[model samples]
Target: MAAKSSQTMTIPTDAELVQAQADLWRHSLSYLTPMALSCAIQLGIPTAIHRFGGAASLPDLVTTLSLPPSKAPFLSRLLRLLSTTGVLASNEAGIYSLVPLSYLLVDGVRIDGDASQTALVLAVTSWHYMEAAMGLADWFKKDIAQPVPSPFEEVHGAALFEESMAVLDPECDKLFNEALAAHDHMGIGTVLRECHALFSGLQSLTDCCGGDGTTARSIVKAYPHIKCNVLDLPKVVDKNPSDGLVNYVTGDMFHSIPPAQAVMLKLVLHFWSDEDCINILAQCKKAIPCREAGGKVIIIDIVVDSSSGQMFETQLLMDVAMMVYTRGRQRDENEWSSIFAKAGFSDYKIVKKLGARGVIEVYP
Candidate 1:
């Protein structure tokens, strides 16, 4: 009877222990944390407190957010998690104060054109990211098990570029464009400071995939001679400029890009698979003059394994993001070189050690 009980035991044996250890990944899946965070931002919890004259007590927060009396304990638990993340601060008496990150939640914080929060909201719940999250486990596997069976293919049943057109609801487009520009602003600031030489001898530059002209405007401000143009979809330019400096041109980069001494393609190529990148690059090659005329493509993107420093986990997170959103894959130096060659480019130089990104000068 004792032996039979031992044989039927529910507790793990040594092999089962190893299997359970491997399966512990289910606990490690913490994306729900950020999803919850996004929900808070969407609910304008921080903005409500700001309107309430800042520093909110627990009871005050409950009232402001209008929680039911029955869920009071659960609401406190949520607040505790937000506090632990430094998104919201707690006073000595346990009243919560808004932090810098929370300030992003306030709609009218930027008198000019601060679009950071809008982008954040779009990025978190975007279909691209949702599809990628659906394929997260497939990223770990060595082989794709089916025809056109990439993790992205599995989720979207199509390529990234296809979905870009499919995701054409007006509200979503606004959020996505806002996020794109806000993200570019951060990347361009770092690129301008670190890779200034890449811009040398270029009389004008066009940000081909630049949404709403954030990076181009910054460039035109910094270098008065370097006239900048922002080329994007018709919808992107539809809203008349509120406060951007560079002129906006509605066009497609795949067929034609505006003429420039050098074209800046930041965070664009990674959205396309290599074939599509080649198509875009071939157009870029046509848009500019030869290298002697300072004709080149200034690419600010990740060359994933370039012997650089610590990558923000966001970088790797985005690689999987590309896999789901488009057929694109983030490349290392070798992979980038291959794409350049495929695009009929001669040579390229990479300069790393920038802020969480790499700057590459690709010559045609």
Candidate 2:
């Protein structure tokens, strides 16, 4: 009787078998989500629906997108998939409408030029990124002692920051830059508005590794009295000439940062390893004044926390993306504290949470 009971327990129940199959299918087919999203964005489906008063029927989308009558069925299937994925909404009457997510994809919806997330989506879904993602499994199988820094480097034969993409495809480089600038604009705008106290008395600030002076220009716009200097590579600063408001300085962050009351490293440190981050922070410490003089380093990056539901999930996704593209990983609070202490920072404070990221103020 005991043996028979054990055998019965070993056999999977009907419900357990069905659930296991469902879980396997869901995980296997997860790649289709991004592919479908990319296709919808490329086809300008969001813009088309927006043009039709943010709600459109099947025939309306066909006419607006200039699809042939024969392709109407396929378009319907695409819309149905998008709706199921929560990218859009559909009613029993077959009318489709834009949800919050689709609004960012509509052309001209953002007042700030090129500040929408559309370019970012396109850049991430581009061929190079997809190629790198496909190579991640094989990259894991390689010897750990191998010098292949990341899956992207393994696939592309060069690091992401080595200007390999720019050399190989100028258009991709431009798109990626645009995406970064857009994200900077959105993030900095929020920080300035919500955390005004952080920059209240700053007289001079340096934007370390600032790309094309986007963050500097925004800071100058918000606080005209603060003298903003952007430090970056010659290739970046040369193209973006000083607008006479923000000073553009051509230099490397690893060696030195221009003197300032405060130094800002927005989305810069995460691309490097922990040791490299410490070195960069040391440079930042050298650039600022004593803590008593309101000198600090402002960092805007992800602070991974499991308590935050969707934001935590997004952070994890970005952490893996970093693993694939760079040698960096998003740090939790304890990890960040360890790095700060090692870098000779006297103290640090997480001022606020900005979506999936956070504002960290490190004092000398």
Candidate 3:
């Protein structure tokens, strides 16, 4: 059963409506799935299972993860949810196997011959490590879904980009970058695998609001013929080496974007309000040529309802995450179309749907 059954089973049978509502209250209060997965990853459950000869039973899983007898059943419940959520899977024989998503976190999972442990990077999804403020009031009550400024900004008056540059904690910065890189590993890698056709015929592309150029590097690697530039604030470029496959340009997307055949904005617009998005899109408009000249904005981000096949529930949870983290919110097709119209775009097409994000081609 989809974990989403937890989200949609609002009304219950005729006899137990009161009991059902009481049960719903408790189930709705549980937000520990991601946290538990993080704990399992941090404790190296997959690694332990692998070393223990793969596909272990519940007791074996408990032993591998080092749980007490009292907590064994709790661990089993955790595993059950993790399995349902696509992180792990269970068998008829009662053994568990890491799914593709979890195996991707196995230490030394490689790409392009580079082997690095997924240790620190897995923190990206750790609810404790990546906490957003309380958006519950607005989220449960209001229809608007825009995220606030990132949690760091909510507390420290600075965004992650700014903090990465100004903060003196090099170790924290490195770990943070690793987390971003891991996310890029999934996000960038997913798009390249499922939607490479969108990059065809593009000779030049710039990643607006690109931090550290991980996505740009992925794009350039997939389409080596195309020249890619990552445009961000001056501080991010000052700290990062420009020697990668992607050229690094120091600039703000709202002020101006370097000229390119196309502008790629991934996980950016949701950071701003409608007015802010308009400013950024206007700058993107000034950067690219006409659609006939291959001028377009290639956006890889969640378009809320674009692909509701089985991910609608995950998408809704992600929408709440945005509420905690930024003033940005994921938009449905209508919301996107409205933004495109306001930005003076002629037409747009939602391309391939992959995982949580959908590839969108916006014409200038």
The per-prediction CA RMSD against the true structure, in angstroms, equals 6.7, 3.5, 6.4
lDDT of 2 at 184: 67
Give the candidates in order of lDDT, highest first: 2, 3, 1
Which portions of model 2 show Cα errors greater than 4 Å? 1-12, 111-113, 144-148
Q: Which ten residues in a row have the lowest lDDT in candidate 1?
A: 156-165
- TM-score versus the correct structure, for each prediction: 0.72, 0.92, 0.79
lDDT of each: 0.73, 0.88, 0.73
The predicted structure with the larger lDDT, 1 or 2, is: 2
Better of 1 and 2 by TM-score: 2
Could you give the candidate ranking by TM-score, starting with the highest?
Answer: 2, 3, 1
Clashes of each: 2, 0, 10
Looking at model 2, report the run of 10 residues with the lowest lDDT sum: 107-116
Best candidate, TM-score-wise?
Answer: 2
The residue ranges of model 1 lying beyond 4 angstroms of the native Cα positions read 1-29, 48-57, 68-70, 85-103, 126-132, 135-178, 193-195, 198-201, 233-250, 290-292, 305-312, 352-355
